[model samples]
Target chain A: MALHYSPVLWNRQKRLYDLTMAGLMALYLIIFCTLQTSLFPPITTETIVIRATSTLAFLMLHVILVIGPLCRLDNRFLPLLYNRRHLGVSMFIVAAVHSVFSVLQFHTRGDVDPLVSLFTSERQYGSFGQFPFQPLGFFALLILFVMAATSHDFWLKNLSPRVWKTLHMSVYLAYALIVMHVALGILQQETSPVYAGLMGVGVLTVSGLHVMAAFIGNRRELHPNAPATDGFVAVCDVNDIADNRAKTLMVNGQNIALFKYDGKLSAVSNLCRHQNGPLGEGKIIDGCITCPWHGYQYLPENGQSPPPFTEKIETYAVRCVGTTVWVNPQPYPPGTPQTPALLKVTTINDEN
Target chain B: MTPPLRRAHRFIWLLLVVALPLGFLATRPTKQSPWLQEPVLPPQSTAMPVLLRTIDADSLVLNLRQSVRGTERQLEILLKQPFETPSAVVCIRQEGSRRAVGLLNAPGLYRFPLPTGTNRPLVEIVDDVHGRTVKTVQL
Candidate 1:
């Protein structure tokens, strides 16, 4: 379409550009997986692909979480800010392969239906030699299934962001359970402590970083969430919005993610339509606030996603006076056009 | 979190992570009874309360497949009940070591060969499937 000669154009579209590159990463994965199976015979082809892809997907999603915020922490990192949604969708596909392969591997192994073994496998529950940890992994995989299925924008519109976001939050627990599953079941049974140790380190490091960032950054609720005074109210200091990425406000008792972008800010429902990652935690990538768990992006101005992705969020108007910031509590539909008041940096001449 | 402080906490955290599994390993309970460590159940544990009291040095070497048959059950034989197996020579022990040689005889006895008259130590038939002592024949 059109470029804003304003150097700001780079920041605006860099996310899209970053996303385009991220898409290539998936293609690379597809190629890498294809070549690996071709080179190794005797190793079941589907098993290898599912295993590689599932592992890669899990890793990539974690990277998306880490990278999205890091990119926002610094403007120069904007170039690295890319379409994270593709990364998310692609990871899901690989995870789907892993899930499918696992099911097939566990359910069928010849004429003797293996389904009989899953429950009675003895390894399925705690026994003298068996560890009671299979159900945890099973449950995590099921959670991933739901998160992936409802990742599209259509589901966000139908289910409502509040419900969708809450469901998505379960990913954290799923991840935690997966760790336990590996520890008690796979690591305990398999003699390879090194492999188990490495995997544990990988997951723990990524999770640790997120927790670290959350604590290091603003942990204070600057403005105690004001009871809905009037229809809606400003939730946090304009300085707070500019200082930290976002804050939750009870507007009409509904929590929304107040967004800050390009010296201008907008308030929208905090829940991400894709996987329910925190919209507030998402960085201003490509001039859009993205979901932290899965890279779902929405324009702060109008809540509609950048083209090709149809996700949207409820929109609200944010006004700033001197240093104070106020938010109109009323939320419009995601696709509705919003003419939010833009901030005009102070002019030397206007200064009394 | 400064890098050093963060690292310290992490180091401790990692140490803790390391400590847990090691702790688990240290506290892990295992079936360490030598006599009751074989594939076939060693004669019931002498330590475990058992009714049938029999002490004999009946040792033989034989192929297990052709000897004992039917389900192997952990029976607490009463002192008054008849205690017998398909093979009269059910098990053999090394002279000293509690390690026992368990010969499952489905129907045939002495179906295999052994180092006749030589007892190295002890022979305790340990049920490897479940750490249970089935028969303990002492010389």
Candidate 2:
């Protein structure tokens, strides 16, 4: 497929996004450096961690909002699209930190249960003027957790993608709740409007991007299918399939890839189970073929992930005849898998 | 994945979540200083005029603040003793040649640093807590 995507501008934009996140965090701390000693946290390790984690969480929400529509604006953004699960997971991590640190600072005393104490505090569940509970903030965090858990391909496979997408979209509602929570809970207590304004800006930016996606993205055209393969007929020259890297092949009425890496070469399903990202387009690292879109790595031999990760994909058989390679497209028994038959790479171009 | 590895991953995340807050609540501190160490004692002679708390006799230390005034000094010692005088000039010292180390404020804390040795007979302290007492001692 000779599709011209991955525009130079889009790559530049990605680099810019990465740098901007780093710069924003630096600026955030620099602005507060003078007040750190005077603040409630007052130069403690825990306080630093709390501030850092909260700042990171806010950054992630903005990234989520921006990246979605940006991909729609250009084809290159599609790669960013494929790995959004990892991004969501990363966001959950920071949010978890912020929540924990907050509970520790506010609710813990002697032997009291921290979770119980959060609700029990008079400052939380009070009257309207003092309506505590931090219900808005907590609600937001709970939604984040739900989204993170369901961000995996397993969930996409188990739960229909449409439902999964809708459920995960509740993050936007969670985002709104978080804004109110922060504004009322923290900014109100401090009598400062600066934080409130910043939060509003973050929410607006994200919401704006989604609105743009809705306008431009054609739901019917997304994920168009490819012409199915005929029989087990290999495409790429054997020489082009690098050691541990993948080269796309049309074989035995299916699109598969040949992977040679980590002292092993094998054939397997070409479509990324997560988002149908081309498995062949990804490179191999540390014995695992990492999806270039989101860096989800899989073992090439049997497509099993390293222990504890449990991600796996179907495998296929392959053979080499003189200068060319061949693959049998029938998928193998999954679950507990072994390397597909390996064919010795006999260099044809060496003599010619 | 085997059940154990799957469980390990699940538990690690749980620990991460739990440890984040629980850790913050669980960590506190303490206070110990060098000033509490006892200072060395001078030779044990009557000339030093030191009173003894009878509970501990073999091992001792002294750190007396030196600021004495008046030709007739008052010695208030929290120790076992024989009343040796009334309204008289006194020279108190180790059980030896006459020399005095008068006591202006004697009721001070005495810490028993170490257990007594059997080689020396025990020192005894006798005192009445609730009593109208007039202490006039000659050394």
The CA lDDT of each predicted structure is 0.54, 0.52
Model 1, A1-352: lDDT tens digits are 1111232224446566556656766676777777777787667866676657656765766665566435434445444534454455566666667666765776666456564554445453434323555566567777877887876556655687556655665665666555555555545645555856676566666555555544443343233456543443545556666532666554554556776666776777776665445567567787877765446678878888888767777888666545556677777877666665456543223432
- How big is the positional error of residue A333 in model 2, measured in Å on the Cα after superposition? 25
Error of model 1, residue A66, in angstroms: 4.1
Tens-digit lDDT track of model 2 for A1-352: 1012232223454565545655765676666554675675447867777777777777777777677657645547765665455566777887898888888887785367887666655453434334553566677889999888777556766785445655765765676556555544555444344654666566556555555544443331122133323333444456766676776654444556578765456776665555444566677888777765556567777777667666577787655545466565677765336545445554434322
DockQ, each predicted model: 0.05, 0.01
- TM per candidate comes to 0.52, 0.40
In terms of TM-score, how similar is model 2 to the real structure? Answer: 0.40
Fraction of real interface contacts that model 2 preserves: 0.00
Q: What is the TM-score of chain A alone in each candidate?
A: 0.57, 0.52
TM-score of chain B of 1: 0.29
Which lDDT tens digits does candidate 1 get at residues B7-123? 343454344445434433432343122232345444434222222223333342311221133222122222222224323223444454343334453432222222334322233
